[model samples]
Target chain A: MSELVHPLHRFIRPSVKYSTFCPGCGDGTVTQAILRAIDGLGMNLDDFVFVSGIGCAAWIPSPFFNADVLHTTHGRPIAFAFGIKMGLPDKKVMVVSGDGDLVAIGGNHLIQNARRNIEMVVLCINNGIYGMTGGQAAPTTPMGIRTTTTPYGTVENIFNISRLVMAAGASFVACWTAAHPKQLTNSIKKAIQKKGFAFIEVFSQCPIQFGRKTGVGSAVQMLEDYKKRSISPKEAAKLSEEELKDRIVVGELVDLEKPEMLEEVKKMKNKARGEVE
Target chain B: MNGKRVQTGRYFMMGNVACAEGALAAGCEFSAGYPITPATEVANRLAERLPQVGGAFFQMEDEISAIAAVVGASWAGKKSMTVTSGPGISLMLENIGFAIGVETPCVIVNVQRGAPTTGMPTVGVQGDMVQAKRGSHGDYEIIALCPSSPQEMFDHTVIAFNYAERYRTPVFILSDAFVGHMREEVVIPEPEKIKTEYRKIPEPGTDPQKIKGFLDEDVAPMPIFGRGFKAHVTSSCHDEYGKRNLIDISALDNFIRKLSNKILKHKEEITLIERDYEGAEIVLVSYGAVARAAAMAAAQGRKEGIPVGTLRLITVWPFPGEEIEKMARGAKHVIVLENNLGQIYPYIKAEAAHDAEVSFLPPRLVGEIQDPEDILRKIREVSK
Candidate 1:
């Protein structure tokens, strides 16, 4: 065996697992935050599983995570991860996919899993574009962005994932950004700690693609844009949709408590045995 | 006196329906699937039957979730199964790997319709015999059974469940569209015996309860999900404790080798290949429904002084290598037959009849069901 072990790079595993991310990519920041949160949640790396779908952000976990990471066929990480988690619920199952992956091709699974509260966590990189597939407009793409599919700027409305997830009956729901590392990490940590379904939509940066097309270059400048263009749920409650034009929303939208599914399964088994739930 | 006769021993049934009944009798509590051609009857019948037995059944929107839901129900401590045809089987490949990795016990019934892609849906075909083994993207062993009749469907479906439960592996029952759709005499057992080797439960009151997913010994330890046990389980390269380990070469290699060997070494107990030998010089090898046609051909050939014999493979996987070699001794000619273009002929060529002459006669559909005339004609051609 080679005797060289780089001590500095060794601590950054899920970090160094990705060598292809663009400099200052928000995906990389969120990726590291996820790994750090895994470290803090007392989860065994051996029981941690990650799944992804098509998109630059989806590619982040394909070869990057040191876990059983699978970059599956486009637009179905939730379905695949649903398999992994349902087949082995004791595992710390999570999915890192893109907005198009969750909302476009796999939208059916997103809401159904949340509605049933399947025991898995889904983290969406809401970069508002299908970056890896040549920057077509995505479901989360804002109304006026100039995309390859929308050269004249989009006419479709954007998706507020937090509101969507809340309406879908997710047990826990939150929103975070790469700009808020500690908060994002904590959100991920809490999501992992939850027993039922957890959904966290991260406003990730796509500097080389979505950002460049929208003239939102300079990683720091895009974040400044995020701060300026984004509004919180509380503020949004007071302001009109017209007032929120050119702005993205932030903050936890819903975090209600409900009975996790597997607990009900346990109760059924007990009931079968004539034991009181 | 009334001259009416009683058909006591058997009742006519569809192959897929029999397989469904077999699963139900064997205590299957969960049925999840999206219906496809040649397999819709099984799904439809189970939808009504499972509820009467106080079990659960759901019609998933597609095949992927159908298999996934069955896998989930299996982990939730229920015996589960799914029924589908070729197109649906293609979508189910991903979770099949997860089942192998996690050693989740479940049954997947494939009522094959013709196709490279949707060829002959309402007709019979045996095209998926190879895909049942290789379509899934991992390296693992499978226990596949092909039933020649509705009676065999009932018998083998129970066997599939038994083997799946005993070893915690995915077991497949391969039936073709003809067999799935054709109604035939099948005696419904008064009550079907469904059996699985249940995993051992965790002892109560530990701060962290331990439910073993994969065992150190060849026998996998039992695990009951949500029984208040805290087990670390995963579908990745895992240790005995079920932790996801990526590059641990020793652990992974040992697991792959052992899991294959643990069942394979006892091939005698698991393999169920039937043979007919009375100093026969010509042997006809067949499986699934074609075996019946081959058997009829062989019997007629024997009457005609051709000295023909038949080998019926009940356990399609583990391929009964030792038994085939034993039966092939002193045989002058062996003919392999199947629905596809000789999918399993190469195995016999590679292992069984390396020294003897081996010929593969590809019959394209259930319309002929492996023509006795075709085998007889091939036998004469080979003899000359």
Candidate 2:
């Protein structure tokens, strides 16, 4: 068993001999799905730069991936990735961060990047709570759910991340869970191929920190819940809003073509320099 | 230095505009900033200039994202900068510490205003002197410069970028509202005459990931992303290979010591001062806008048969302790004048106490520059 090799071993850093993910954590599945997407793209590893903010999901790419990874401060991966994309417009920049890191403190960056339609792929791993910090309520944590900070239950309404990005004018947006690995991988692939502000929020599980408190005590149970509650956008449209309140509407929410920010900046610069009419 | 030089000429330019021009001359290709009073002009200038020069400028969502983007752009292989005021600097502290931790080279311009939280927007103050050095959490040294006039604002900005690139740390141009907003004849040097130094890049094809000791005493060459150097950069304590090492005390100690000592070890090269200590009984210690007042007062004191000299600090951090101590020893009194409630006076007092008596003239009001007559009065008072 020790000699047995994982197929994704080529992409993993040999120095980090063990995974930091907890047993039954869905972060591993998400990581594998992203790796599979990159592999399927037939892109050179050097051509990709993986940027992340602080969290369990942030750790997914930091020391684990063989590609150039920038592990930045919490809640600022999109901003950091913005810099990277602006500096090297040719390289494919991807941001992998957690829901708390994105929708909470970094929510401004998320919406602003969407508004500008900057070219990058953002993988927001939504585990419903702050898994690394012991299940604190996050912006995405459903209302009435019990968390470390909200012992009685959360009072605030949850952020509909897909709708938020869609409203902000992202070129591509989608939501999928680890239960739908194949579809998640495909969405990631399409996002990478997309040219402007691609955001994919992957629903992941935190059995130890979030599941036990939320009544889904095991990873398998959480996956079952996701499968049971998940619905496609078309299917969700058929159901009443009240009936779809607890359901996860999965699949591409928006896909459109727009002028990317960097290209516009280049054109603006050329016009300013009198090199273009 | 590697780029083609633009034509040079004299222009009646505001200090903030000169600062933007200096950045352009020094090869800064990326800037991200959030507008605040006084410093807004710097952003405005960059917004207009960067596009003409084929560089990128972003008005970030806020100060935090502004500096964070600058750090990111620096890692992506561009000379980057950001301009802000006290409030913005306060917001950028966390990421500034991140820049220090990763040893990323960038420049920050703080056109200081009255502080403690939105004190006076239009008024210039030198209150952020100590904050510029110690604002970010952690044990690290930074390079900070203060410019007294529009010309120096332009000159020091170029020096700030050069030092930031040479040291691989965030260098600050600590101009005040007075200098940032004031207009003067700034002689723009031909690009060839403007000397700039960039960070040393690793030899092509060398795997930066395989190399260790990036923060060694000698300082490792920077290997930016997308250049085939697959390096992992983090804000946490890390080993030589850029891998996270949270528990190892020795590695942490080595990294921290090097991060600080790289500046301390080259204090002579980093420290810049203008001094006239000959036959001086009183010395006026000053920086930024207040330095102009002190210089005029010192000249007046000399004309009035008092032996008054001045020590103008160009580089404020890695504080010119040795120069201050030597100057203090030869003088009977050292008077520190600034547009704040004695922020840097304590450092001067600490360095000059045993050798000479130190006096402070804090800001008279929120936006007031120290009157030359007031500084002259202090010089006369101390001399008597």
Candidate 3:
């Protein structure tokens, strides 16, 4: 009998026998969801160029995926992706990074690219803490959490990353958690097809670091908590502010048709050449 | 709507504008920059001109993003560049190191102004001479060209791009505010006459597993994205196939040495010097704006019956020690002239001090070029 292989294994690098993710890490689930999204869309990996910044989530596409991947410096993958998209306007450019990488250090790039409405997908794996650096307090870390750097518990409010990108004029924006892998994959597929800046903020679980700090204890427990707190936008709208205080809003926040940067650049080039008015 | 890549005519042009023209002639498809003094003209020219020739220039949010975009564009199979000054260079050093680590080819132009930190944006100074090589915080080699005039601004930028592509590394055009803002006659050659080079890429349909696109002594063909090579490019220490190898000591060693040797091995071809040191006892070694004063001083010294010569460094980084050493061998005194307080002087001294008395002759003031009289007077003192 022939050996059984997972369908998504085809997207993994042939030389990589195992993943670098820690056991029970949500990054692995995020990785699989991304590959599944591509697989379901019947798109060749060649059609995409994946860029990631310095973080565990960044490693999802770097040495793992069997595609063109640019694993860049800390907090700069979105800036780098702007160039890649401009150079290869026909190819899809996607940026995968952690919350600390995307929201804290790389926030300017994220905001600027969203404002430009550049045609690309930025999947921010919001793990809440800096897991790779051993549970440091990230900008997205919830208040009153005792992290490595915040032993006294964080006093700062967490940033709503999806709302931030949506405010910054992204054409498409969505929020989902790791527990909702099927829906996350569906969003990824739609983001890949979007003609302007598409941002997906995935509330991922970092069981070893964040789980230990937040008393969630394990990946299953974290997922169970996510399932309990997750609410659709419709349900969220009906709830009172006090009642919806801790609930995670999970759904598309905005979807709009806008002029993209590269397409505008093309039109400018044609106009410069006197081929267009 | 004339989309000529090279405007073949003589025109009085600003140094920064000439630089933009040179980049266009060298086939630069993309550029990104932020507005900083002594360098804004380059960005302005590129923004207006690139679209006509089927290229693009993005004014990024900051210098870091500007350089990041340039490196990204290079990996996507485009010749790209970024322009800035000292303050901007400080922000770009980290990503510059990233570009070096991954062997991405791109050009960086620094229109230098006075600074320890944003001191004088409008005044020219050779303050950042050493920063171009050492600012990135790693043991690596870099190529830098020092253009003295508006004409050299046009010429050196072309060389900068060609060297960037041929070596698959970042090449710098180190122009000071004096040269960057100066207006002079620049002769633009026909597009066919301008030598342009593109980075070598793997032959079409080459197997991805077998393609060695990094850490080659001779530059490896770049495995650009969207080419079905599935090229894995990382700023981390990686193997020939662009695989991340963090555990092995030998892999780290090879990563450091190979990326450096790729430039060091071709040093003879990479170094450019204008030699006029023959039959002289006193040699004035200078580059960029100071070289103009040095050349004048040398001519005046000859008329005054002193055996004074000039060795103008056209390519300043990768240190150009051999050229300095060779020039020093034929001289009794090697005097380094610079606008700032002796940045490259120690390096020149290290190379030439063994053979001759090496000393630095700084300009009368930091922002001003060295007066020819000051250089000639220094030459007389050294000769005596």
Candidate 4:
């Protein structure tokens, strides 16, 4: 009896010190949201798997979470997670990452997975700037924003993650802000329950680098801005194109209708062998 | 070096093909990889054998996926591996780093070729020796085994898988293009005597899987899918409960430091070296095909009365330091012969210190074997 209980207490790990995130940073909130989501969903502790690339948000899962986590080289978790999922489809898999990990270094995998609709959930922690790499401008840094990498100002346009994932044909694509805890948690739950590739883009805040440079307010103020700047998903679609030019759309935008990647592969296999129509 | 019966199989094949056969006989159930030279035969052979044995074979998009797939398959309760060479190895560094970081069990075969960058694709070079130890951009330890003849290719590969599953970390059979392409007599491991282990996934399709990977210890139970438990995997540094923590210093510290310490703690079980110390004034240190030549040279030296012994490092990384150090400190001189220029000599000298006079024989001899007479002469020169 004692032996069985002894093993039960294992798997608890500590995390990294001096988070690259600033106080009131939404990435911290997003990280907690994911852990809480895992706790809430009652997913298998041993079977829980997470993978991330190099970034502030990417490090979120690195030092913590005792599940089968892999702190990979930058921007390749999607490729890494693809193997984990396909190799062991019984496990509930997730990829915790930032704009650079998901949209930049790992963008190819993101688009491909969306297109294939592999059975997994992608929690894209899109904190506006590259927080870990000393506030470099990422592909998600909005137009004209100044970052360490872009001192004058970023000339590149930002990638609206959910919109892109939806366009790429993910089976499920949802957007929420880290500040909106209830919505974020709800979307996470839905994503956990979804069969196909469920993509949830959480617009998080990095008040340290991008915020200090642009003279933005505290982490809390950034959350308020997140609340005000983004229109609800339902209303934005109903609004005119001009009304949405500066507005970010936040909601479940794509609830797709298609088979998951595994099923499709199986179908392909059966077809190749002429076992089924 | 031990006189175990080397049962020669009745099959004409390449070194890599025998390696795959050895893997199958040892009960390898899955292979995930993208094919590259010298190493491609292992992948090709698995592609044929896996289906026949009710196993699985997947040609991953690239080396990264191949290793990752093997890691995942291992977690799903299968013995797994991947094979590649040169450039593909550069890509494998990240996940290989992950395997070390997380302590997952699997085999990775790198058929070494000449390369600072594609130096020689189809050619042989042991140049990747240092890179094998320091490749993954971290301070973790590595376990690399080099095989010279086709027989060692089969034997060492089987041994590589065993070591991997035993330690639950990546073990490499660092074959060169020569060892891979050359055909020779190899004793395939009998299915009964060959040892194997699979990941500890949950029972088939039952309850919610609820154990943390790498929680209390350096190792964790594997969580395979369809075995009745839902698993969550991450690339992040995690806790004992396997939950991703955002800022746990101790967790990160323990997880990272445990890498070197774990291998060190099990040094006896992990390290392999063949030493012919005898009454020798000089020693020839080498591995893989080069070691074979060094052995012949040492034998020839004895016949000529210039007492020479050979030390073969089977486990290249986390090198057989303790033994080599003792032997070198007592030797009159040492010579390091390799296919590449001076890569491994520095390591031997570093271990032996200023005690042993050292000499190096490089790859310039190319296609031809190192002249035993020349190496013996160098040994005599160093001793004098």
Quick one: best TM-score, which candidate? 3
State which candidate has the highest DockQ.
3
Candidate with top lDDT is: 3
| Candidate 2 lDDT for residue B382 | 78
* TM-score, A chain, model 2: 0.96
Comparison by lDDT, 2 against 3, better one: 3
Candidate 2 scores a C-alpha RMSD against the true structure in Å of 2.0
Task: Quote each prediction's TM-score.
Answer: 0.73, 0.97, 0.99, 0.79
Candidate 4, B61: how far from true, in Å?
4.6
The collision pairs in model 2 are: none
Q: For candidate 3, lDDT tens digit of each residue in B27-119?
A: 999999999998999999998889888899999999999999999999999999999999999999999999999998999999999898979
Ranking by lDDT: 3, 2, 1, 4
CA-only RMSD, every prediction:
7.8, 2.0, 1.2, 6.6
> What is the CAPRI rating of model 1's predicted complex?
incorrect
Give fnat for candidates 1, 2 and onward, in order. Answer: 0.10, 0.75, 0.81, 0.27
TM, chain A, every candidate: 0.89, 0.96, 0.97, 0.89
Model 4 Cα displacement at B182 (Å)? 1.8
Best first by TM-score, ranked: 3, 2, 4, 1
Residue-wise C-alpha lDDT for candidate 1, range B109-189, written one tens digit per residue: 999887878777877778888888888885667888988888888888888888777777788998887778878888855
User: Candidate 3 vs. truth: CA RMSD?
Assistant: 1.2
